[model samples]
Target: MRSRSLVVPAVLAGLLAGSVADPASAHEQVSTPSAAVVGAAPASRVTAGWTLVARYGFDGGRPTPIADESGKGHTLRLVTRNGGTVSAVRHGIGHALRFPGKCLTGRRCPHAALQSPSAPNLNPGTRPISYGAKVLLSPSQTSKGQNVVQKGYSATSSQYKLQVDGAAGRASCVLVGARPGIKLITSTVSVADGTWHTVECRRTARALTVLVDGAVRGNRAIQPGLSVANDRPLSIGGKGAYSDNDQFQGTLDDVWVRVG
Candidate 1:
């Protein structure tokens, strides 16, 4: 409802012409693991061995009381702050949810996100886990960083997160384990090209990998013994209704999480 009056800039039609992603943060202690571009794998093959913990096709416009298609019963609750809004948008053969971009220059920007109640099944402690979404973002929507999906908090507890960072909008996967270290991997390419792209974050015992359209874009070595488990809700589209949240400003569909 609130988004009906919002007008997007026409400049979004053109993709990033000559944008280079910023280097990873020095405090994050980023690492580069061997990247293996295994080519695009079919949908069926992508989840061949993993168990689907939660999945949201966002069909029918992501109506309230959002259902989790995985049948694992991880229903998502919508959260809004300030004047944040969520609206329906056309995507491929079905529909998706579109979120507001940055807040007006000095205005208290809107904030909206979807969160799931704490569930043990969603916590894949010490296990290989993968999560991702089909996203459509424009250069104008890029921000310092916007969370796509995450469980737990990096500062207070272990966490597994996927987010698009910097003006380049290069996706990244993060792993904060039981120890006092963070494992992060950022994509070598940007996805803020005003097109649909599948971005996934895969965490294994060996390393943390980021995949764009099923090809490895970046990888970072991680401790094999690390574990992630917490009572925090699984958040999507941003961190929640909090102020200065990492709100995502784009369309999202077919979000899913799997573990082995």
Candidate 2:
């Protein structure tokens, strides 16, 4: 993977401040949206619902994939370029939704960052590895239940990694256990056709169902009894380990999140 360029001193300072300042705020005296703002323009000029939390089109040279929205919801959408990847991150300062990936190797890459107080920043890290197409979510630290849905085309790769702060394993997906033991969940799907596909994971009342493009892919009943924390922010194309330099190597679009 490549290292991203040094974030602009001002932008980095602003990002580190936990509040994103509008470019025109300091000198031009322009008003910026607060975390309460929601349902504004999308990054790709695509139309979305009024409750849109976050959206991305990957139309710029930067790595951050968050859309400039009104800041209503806590969800985020990441769009990948020809061979780019997107990631949703939650840092300690606030909620920074970003997509930092490797393209040419050893070069500094750009990533997305969104700061919001409404969401908890859990499991902070560098990046994770994703094969084919995937979506990641860091559940609310206050809630024991969680869900994630991914829809896109699948590709072939030697590495397909998904890491959760709550679990550790080699399974396609694993739920960490802050209490007792970690449970591993794996699903089989033919997602390497380079065509759009979808994968979903829903957790409620001790049951988990994995879906592919709206179709059921696998179902698992477990008593891992692992509780997902809302304080942890979700990472998509990257992991929270801050180590494994693996990043998603593909294109992604259209991401959605629903909370109970």
Candidate 3:
């Protein structure tokens, strides 16, 4: 599958990680899990299975996905970014899926909870994160939040993901403060809708790989150094900052974090 070009005007802004001291930071302070708890699995254990990390049902005015009417499937994927195009498929017609977007108040909505004391801040000057998809209808209401889960951070490391959103566009996922120190791996081709899209990020001592749906989409290498809290709460549906109101406006289901 090849990617299509979708004109997505950058709108929303990016969130900046902050420096704080608290319990959340304690857990996420170091590159690896602590040794205090013996026989305990490392932080990498979180992503062991297709864990249900965050889910949205699009109910309660929250930016979550509601259960499908037919209770069958609810997801879409894009396989390529060649022409900057993406596609979203609806399973069991009549059901709606929520995509993340800026709020009507010119602000990002609220979705996840932050555990860090000095969580990052969302800047309004940044571009809006774009997703490629055909809006079926103007949802009577939409969500204004996102779910964020952070694993232990290391100066040399990578991450993995199993994500499915409405469509595949130029800017589906946004990485803030991601420089030569930090790398993000994601899928290039969208997955078949109404099913699960498994993606992974492997940050070896050298480069990074973004697996789309199942195949690799992007690959690059760079020197790395990232400052992240070890005990920070792996937030879901929202950023770590309790102050910022930027939330993911979509539905998330089955999230898992583990060591590569």
User: On TM-score, who's better, 1 or 3?
Assistant: 1
Pairs of colliding residues, candidate 1: none
Local accuracy of candidate 3 as per-residue lDDT tens digits, 193-224: 33334334433334444443333455554334
lDDT of 1 by residue, 155-244 (tens): 677888898888999998998887667778888889899999999998877878888987778776777888989888888897766565
Q: Ten consecutive residues with minimal summed lDDT in candidate 2?
A: 151-160
Q: Stretches of candidate 3 above 4 Å error?
A: 1-102, 107-110, 114-148, 151-180, 184-196, 223-229, 241-246
Best by lDDT: 1
Q: Identify the candidate with maximal TM-score.
A: 1
* Residue-by-residue lDDT tens digits, candidate 2, 1-260: 11222121213332333322222111111121221111222112112222333333223324442433324434433322222333323332223223443334332443333232224222111111111224323222111111122211112111112322221111133433353433334444443344444443444345444445554444455443344433323434432112222333333434333322
Q: What C-alpha lDDT does candidate 1 achieve relative to the native structure?
A: 0.75
Candidate 2: deviation at residue 15, Å? 6.2
Which scores greater on lDDT, model 1 or model 2? 1
Using all chains and alpha carbons, the TM-scores for the candidates as numbered come to: 0.83, 0.43, 0.37
* C-alpha local distance difference test of each model: 0.75, 0.31, 0.29
Which runs in model 1 stand beyond 4 Å of their true positions?
1-46
In model 2, the runs with Cα more than 4 Å from the true position are 1-65, 68-171, 240-245
Lowest-sum lDDT 10-residue window in model 3: 77-86
